[model samples]
Target: MAAYESAIQSRVDCIEIDVSRSSDEVLFTLHGRQGFTTDIRKHKF
Candidate 1:
């Protein structure tokens, strides 16, 4: 993912995977409860 790539480029020690589950019960990595671009904070993350 681009985020992981960016973190690696920036020399980050580790990257956070903000995980959650979908309605179908599959796990996914995202910051907000909603899908991509749900919240203003999502932009920062």
Candidate 2:
């Protein structure tokens, strides 16, 4: 994830990440979750 970090550190105005709940209800970052753009998922509650 070095590249990702570098890009973010390059004075990016905005950044997006994909997150999903695991079997244990834990959140995770998934790059390939969506086609092209990242998918950020979170608990409704």
Candidate 3:
């Protein structure tokens, strides 16, 4: 994902990714959004 480019380039010691594990055992890592603020919870991942 392009959003990861910044983190990769920066070489940060620790990068946190907001993750939500669904009941189906799927992990969702938070990525940037479009124009306005978005409620990522709206999607069950």
Alpha-carbon lDDT of model 1: 0.71
- Clash pairs (backbone) in predicted model 3: none
Q: Candidate 2 on 1-45: residue-level lDDT in tens?
A: 664686588976666666899999999885543465533444352
Give the C-alpha miss distance for residue 12 in model 3, angstroms: 1.2
- Residue pair clashes in candidate 2: none
RMSD of each: 6.3, 8.3, 9.2
lDDT score, candidate 3: 0.72
> Please, what are the lDDT tens digits per residue for candidate 3 over residues 1-45?
666778688886655577889999998988757566565547785
Ranking by lDDT: 3, 1, 2
Q: Write the per-residue lDDT of candidate 1 for residues 1-45, one digit (tens) a residue.
A: 776777799997777777888999999886434565444445765
Query: What's the ranking of the predictions by TM-score, best on top?
Result: 1, 2, 3
The TM-score values for the models, in the order shown, are 0.54, 0.52, 0.45
Return the lDDT, model 1, position 19: 84
Evaluation by TM-score, superior candidate among 1 and 2: 1
Over 4 Å off, model 2: 33-45
* Top candidate (TM-score): 1
